[model samples]
Target: MATKNVVVDLTKREKLDGTNFDMWHRKIQYLLNEQEVLETLTIVMMRPENGNTAQHRYDLETYESWVKKDHCARFTMLSSMHNDLIGEFENYPNAQEMWNQLKISYGGTSATILRALTLKFEKYVMDSKHSMAEHLRTMSTLIRDLKAASNNLSNEQ
Candidate 1:
């Protein structure tokens, strides 16, 4: 018989820079699901109420600790991957809070940004100073934002 070992490394994860949270979020979701620890972002374990036996109390404590530990690990790992600053969420008790904080911080105000970006996309004029490749790259980045905002540019328009 032969022995083999495999090690998986998850590095260079997509960053959550303010301009691209949607893409960052989907990639992070994939990474979390792959790790079999995605649910820690949502569920929180609660300690038992009064009238429980000592054994039951111990069990609840154990479960709570594990849940917190999992959430903390995911939270710390996630924060490090961000290009935008998320230090305000350092004290959040769970991954869910961290996720929500990102959403709240970057999510609500994006409609205005999308509108501005869309207008910019609509008004983009090619520059004679830039090479064709550079102009295309700039256009492509804008078009990606339009698509991310669920607004597509048809061939006619």
Candidate 2:
């Protein structure tokens, strides 16, 4: 059997501070998926009981595969987090639990944050002095922020 080796370069990526969970979550998800390890964040594999049977050996191989993938996924997540946040998450026993804990801690958009994002989008005006590229980049960021805050706007808007 052939194994796939994936090399991901995260040096250019932004670390996940407490304030950037939405963007960080998306990037981490993409990286995990690319490595074919994203399922480790959602599924738990049980270790097969020790036995002499061939079936047990096959099960052990499957379990070990899960463990390897889980470790990769967990490491990738921790590497992308800020130093301050890493200490809080590094001790999790598995990627699934760590992912759940992160969501519970930072995934929700509060009413105030949502409102602020909406207001910012509504109030943004392109300054003619800036280049069109700059204006487009600012607008794109505002749109992304609003969407991440759960204020989903239609493309027609």
Candidate 3:
């Protein structure tokens, strides 16, 4: 089988600092999906214990493929994160563990965070001194954060 050479360019994207997890998560997930390695974030493949058989050889190949993909996924993830965050995640044995730990650390919203986000969204006002584009961008960011915190907004909101 011919292997596909995927080039991931994360230079244009913002590194995952503590404050931008939602946007970083969305971008990284899309990158991993495009690389066809997103499954490595959730699935763990094991090497076959038995040897010298056709099934063992096939399983070994499958496991190898998984390893290759897992490495790519892990590298892409690490490359997209900030330097300060890398040390916390670099030692994970597999992409799945790293991904899970990230989700647990940054994905889960505590009640206090949710409330703060909601209040910010509700009280936001467009500043007359700022350009409309800047105001819109700020509003969109607030909306994204609120959604990430599991606070759904209606069209009228």
**Candidate 1: C-alpha lDDT:** 0.66
The best candidate in terms of lDDT:
3
Residue-wise C-alpha lDDT for candidate 2, range 7-114, written one tens digit per residue: 234524567766567877887888789888999988999899889899999999999999999998998888888788999999999999999999988788777667
Off-target runs (Cα >4 Å) in candidate 3 are 1-11, 110-135, 150-157
Number of clashes in model 2? Answer: 0
Mind giving the per-residue lDDT tens digits that candidate 3 earns over 82-140? 89999999999999999889988888787876777777888999999999998999999
Clashes of 1: 0
Structural similarity to truth (TM-score) of each candidate: 0.58, 0.72, 0.71
The 0-to-1 C-alpha lDDT of every candidate, in the order given, reads 0.66, 0.82, 0.83
Candidate 2's C-alpha runs over 4 A off are: 1-11, 111-139, 150-157
Candidate 1: which stretches are off by over 4 Å? 1-13, 49-58, 61-65, 108-112, 115-142, 150-157
What's the best-to-worst order under TM-score? 2, 3, 1
C-alpha RMSD of each candidate structure in angstroms: 7.0, 5.4, 5.2
Candidate 2 displacement at residue 17 in angstroms: 0.8
